[model samples]
Target: MGRLGVPPLPNHALATRLADAYRAGTTVVLAAGDVPESLDAAEAIQDAWMASLGTSHAYKLGATIPAVREALNLPRSFYAPVPDDRLFRDGAAVPMAIARQTGVECEYAFRLARDLLPGPDALGEDEIAAAFDAILPAIEIPGTRYGRLAEYGGAALVADAGALGALVVGEPVTGLDPRALGAAPVRLSVDGTTVAEGSGAVMDGGAFGPIHAFVNRARARGRTLRAGEVVVTGSCTGYEVVARGPTIAAHFEALGRSVSLRFAP
Candidate 1:
């Protein structure tokens, strides 16, 4: 492990090569059992990958729900950076060529108005909410440059930016109530059919829970949550794989907002 408690990266060349494949929009898979076993090692690989891509414009939390954690065999949640080029306005067209296996996540996303500097103490939910300038509906497109995500393990997923392919953010919701927002209902549909549905209650502490978790995680890694950065909380509807399709949509019922994406063949 590194001085910060993250494991030392065992394969810098592999990390750089994967980053290059991501940038080139090509699929590349590592040899079997080549993934990191510890969070620190995974974080180190992710840091290296992000450095090759340039600064991240947003962040995403993964495996926040019990079902997802169990599915990934993870004991807890994790965070990953999203490159700026991967963020898209609602209704943007996403080329299918960018990812090998595409999936969708319905989530609530926050855009921070003030910088959240790292400190010794963790921030509470209310404090996390106070830091956000806007709350919006979001559709997260998660994909893997690597083959068979389940074969690689959670640490490998973390290293590949939580398998983030793109983000589609909706219009900001006004008159936000923290309590109601936490319990808000969310649904995801593709090609006019409902594929997954759930509530904000599935989130760790409602909508703001993941933000607090993210802040603490960032601090643990000797980083800070900056202003003007968008943070996508864990999915309300678990990750649902998407076939090559024309469009995908997510609706935040209580928040009264929706986001959509069109996929190109």
Candidate 2:
């Protein structure tokens, strides 16, 4: 039984399906019995998958914007612990032979200087400010293992590891005020043509906002954001659904950095 005597989530079966789909790089359409009906159940399934995967390499946050949350029927942002296998450097050609569709979004990716473990009391401003090492321009290629991806709501996304497919990072920009990043303008280009434009302010205040939220939330669950780990906050520009044959680029102009990847089918 769960905390309130509800039967515990059948995380094992679902996690196995998630893990198998990860290994096979294929889609999974969950049956009613395997589908998670609640956010708690979805989180349990994600944790189970992570446990089976052995270790996590990075964290990805999504659906941070209030409007986006409303569209997904989510009360808050979602996060996923991604494996290193999908963390690609800029200029890498991502093989998309099996993918039917993929979406790209741009954002700030922060590499932590030290662990951000919760203290006995509330975290102060200095503690939050000191947790950063550098910021990088990032474009996330978020995907799903399930069919009719949009029909599934936030809980389904949380279960599918925030729909994280791959993350491509550009050069890190340091020595800049992390708080000021919220005002930075970001542009997304496809095949050298602009497709989307926005600023970091859309990311729930800034790049660090989601980090702050995730820290407190994880700490409550007895987890810590360890040193040297990367936390990628949600999109600045919304997203582009790339069907095939396009080079996507994200430009974080204020920081003078950009990153890009090509989809090769």
Candidate 3:
């Protein structure tokens, strides 16, 4: 039942190539015949790729916004597990080589306090925050090895591990009021010039919708979110692809949490 198209499951050769490209901080432009054509085949390859790397950090969601879903023609949100080396701390710099090739997104993120259980309804804001030990303002650079992005669609992205280029995690918010996150303002800037701005209210039912969607879907696949793993919702401000010289920044109104990353050229 899991086979969607017909390439075969756990494509180890593809997984190895992806793992190598990701660790080298570069992307691969796949050919038409190379793209994963189905969600089942794509996700299976991703699973195998994750196993090949042995890296753990977080899970990221994409296409959470209704407009984005419609635009991408996605049936549901997409998920990818991030590797530790690709994640950065606040105030650091993304190596210029990679920064020049990708874009950045401002997002609301959280770390789980315990394992997550699959559920039917959306978790209330306070209840959702209660399940977490930290709230983070983040910048996600969704990178993909399959370079011609518009051609492949969701299946290709799922195979490329949600196209996660890199992530810059902001300082943790110490006293966030989850109840207020629905209206929390998020901003993204380049060299201190505001490029895009939006609030958490834009997500389906506040920012937690992605997490709930991820949890239910993941559990159905026999996976459960564990403590200490981070979950990043889709971008508040759509991702901005820029050049290598300027500083990229993100800020969230959750107790003034922010992330500032310089690009080293």
Candidate 4:
């Protein structure tokens, strides 16, 4: 038994069950009070989930903004793996049947041009920016294989792969100005009505802050932040639930790039 008398599941069995739930497009709740309590346990579940997915294409940052932390009651930020199969380009059609309860979040994404090697010290914001070759507008669609996300704690959410459904990446923008980018406005709309909006400043450490933090955390876990992998930083606009009938779009005002997804009934 672990914290709160929640017995930990064997890594392989937990991963297999999670993967099955995802593939079957069904919800699977843990036993009452069975959530993992430590980051290590949560991360082990995360690793198992990622391994089950096979290929890792991108990373998603969670609780990067104060609002998110407050809403989820998390003390700090966390990272989750985004598998390649869940990534889609702009204007992709998302099947609502696959993701029953979907929400959208506007975000900034960066793709590294060079490998970020692990070191004793954490990478600074400027160094993190320099490592990226391009910046892009992104919209993250979050879904859960649970009945209600609020019922689960932060560690449980982490083990559930951050509730990430799919990432819609827009066209890459080059020659970005850091200062200007950090102040950029982002908006999310459902069926032409704007539901949520904010700026890069909404993130606790600014636009590049999450990237810096993710790298350091990964390195600390004996993992390397590889090149050619996309990093979807924290959302500028908070998560807004989108109904099945509407078209959802996220616009990056300064970058002049937008990504849209339509849910098919």
Return whichever of 2 and 4 wins on TM-score: 2
Candidate 3 ranges with C-alpha deviation above 4 Å: 1-10, 25-33, 97-100, 117-129, 175-179
Question: Lowest-scoring 10 consecutive residues by lDDT in candidate 1?
Answer: 1-10
Write one digit per residue (lDDT tens) for candidate 3, span 75-150.
Answer: 7777877778778888877885555365778888888888865434445545656777778888887777765454
- Candidates' lDDT values, in order? 0.77, 0.76, 0.74, 0.77
lDDT of 4 by residue, 128-218 (tens): 7788888888988887767766558777787788886888898888887543576777889887888888988878668777777788777
Error of 1 at 63 (Å): 1.0
TM-score of 3: 0.85
Greater-TM-score candidate between 3 and 4? 4
Once fitted onto the true fold, the runs of candidate 2 whose alpha carbons sit more than 4 angstroms away are: 1-9, 97-100, 118-122
RMSD (Å) of each candidate, 1 decimal: 2.6, 3.3, 3.9, 4.3
- Cα-based RMSD of candidate 1: 2.6
- Listed in order, each prediction's TM-score against the native is 0.89, 0.89, 0.85, 0.89
Candidate 4 Cα deviation (angstroms), residue 235: 2.0
For residues 1-265, what per-residue lDDT tens digits would candidate 1 score against the true structure? 1123456677787688778878777766777666777766777888777766767768888888777788777778888878878888898888866655577889888887788765567777777777777778888888776765555777778777778778878888755754457666798888778888998788777767766777876876667678878888788888788777568899888877889987776
